[model samples]
Target: MSTYSSNQEQFMYQTIIKWITDDRWMMDILRNVRSLSLPDSWVCAGFVRSKIWDQLHQIEPRTPLTDIDVVYYDATDLDKKTEKVWEQQLSRIQPELPWSVKNEARMHIVNGIAPYDSTVDAISYFPETATALGVRLDEQDQLILVAPCGLTDVFEMNIRVNPHFLQGRGDMETYTQRIQQKNWQHTWDRLTVVDS
Candidate 1:
């Protein structure tokens, strides 16, 4: 079964499209990330999450990002060391940005889960529903947003554990720790956390 129904999926896509298209900084960030030419790459997680939350809260979008997560799928080169190479390339492209490149192909070992089939697959298991979003600009500069968890929690300002991450006891522990560590409500006063 799909995580989101067709109509909900479409609405989420449209909302992301409109937001990214209307924001020049986001467009620039996407364009820069795209320039890396990584296979099946996308600027994901909090890169998109924080923006939506900021907008919803009527706060400035200028909040410092924890990291500009750049995720890609390259099965041929699963070496975790190679991720740093991509990170360096991204740094050269945007020297001032805090870029973090991750190869989803090998991340399963780090997370103690099965291998991810693609970047979106890895995103689907991210700890928070809101942080599972990803965005990329295609060759034609068309914006594509991948949200396997949908946009309900994000638009509603809720933080909930991903169903996929709930399967393992370790993952559940990690999820709980992540929520406490984030302390999102301290910043976004209206944020809601659903641990159950």
Candidate 2:
């Protein structure tokens, strides 16, 4: 028996799929990113967050993205410099695209936390559960979603900090600062921001 995503999750995933299919650039970017075949890789974070938020806001599908974050996990090589190499390669593939590559293996040191076992594990540490989502294209050219925190907050346009980030006082402060700085409400006025 093949288990499937919940109906709501399937709806959300279909929305993303339609949006990406409608845009040539988005499909091209995913294809290029997948070409690299980095270990356990996914184009995650705002790439997924902004799209869902944009759809909820009922705005044009043309939300300006600051960076396209490509996160991967490779235990054998934890060298930070390798991420830069990946960035350069992506830049060459699409000069106009804003690409940010990160390796989850060494990110624990940068984040001052224990090592993350995989890309999904690192995504869970993201400040907001809504933001802790990822998507990628598999070898079959099918879209695959890896949302560790589920799709509830994002689908509801709720901006609440993730419980994981609440453990550290510093993390809480950083999350607050990020909420203020992002000011997503300015753009998506309908958003329900719960700042704790």
Candidate 3:
């Protein structure tokens, strides 16, 4: 069962799409990722989450991202070096941007989980519901959102642990440490951090 109604989901989806569409820098970043032509790729995590939070906070001059996380699924080649090469490519294109590219195919080994079915599946296992969100630009340049946990928590500015992290599949200590390290509440004062 969905935590939110379909109507609410649609509204959030449209709102997010509109926000990204209106931001030229975000669109250019999407274009650069698209140029790589990686299969089932997206700019995920803080890239999309921070934008919504910033807009909700009504902050100006957008919060600078620590890194631009570009994720993709390619079961054929799981080489870590290739991910670095892609990151270097992105850096060459936009020297100022902090790019971090990862092949989700090999990430399972690092996360100590079974191989993910796809990039979206990998996102679903992210620590927080809000951070699990991903965005990509389609061939038509239309925004595509992959929200395995839905967008209610993000739109509502609520920070909740992803069930995947709560389950035995993940470690609570790690999740707790991440929340503390991120200190997201300090930045987005309107946020509500939920405990499970």
Best by TM-score: 3
Local accuracy of candidate 1 as per-residue lDDT tens digits, 80-173: 8899988887788778889889888988888787788888888888878888889999999999888887788898889998887676224677
The 10-residue segment with the lowest total lDDT in model 3: 1-10
The parts of candidate 1 lying over 4 Å away from their true place are 1-9, 168-170
lDDT of 3 at 48: 98
Q: Give the per-residue lDDT digits (tens) of candidate 2, residues 1-196.
A: 1122689877876777777666677778889999999989988988888877777777785688999999999988889889999999999989898899999998888878778888888888788878888888888888877767777788888898888766522367777888899998898888888765
Ranking by lDDT: 3, 1, 2
Over the stretch 56-151, how does candidate 3's per-residue lDDT look in tens digits? 999788988999999999999999999999999999999999999999999998877788889988889889999988999999999988888889
How much RMSD separates candidate 3 from the native structure? Answer: 1.8
* Candidates 2 and 3, the one with greater TM-score: 3
Model 1 RMSD in angstroms: 2.0
Residue 103 CA error for candidate 2 (Å)? 0.2
Clashing residue pairs found in predicted model 1: none
Q: Rank the candidates by TM-score, best first.
A: 3, 1, 2
TM-score of each: 0.91, 0.91, 0.95
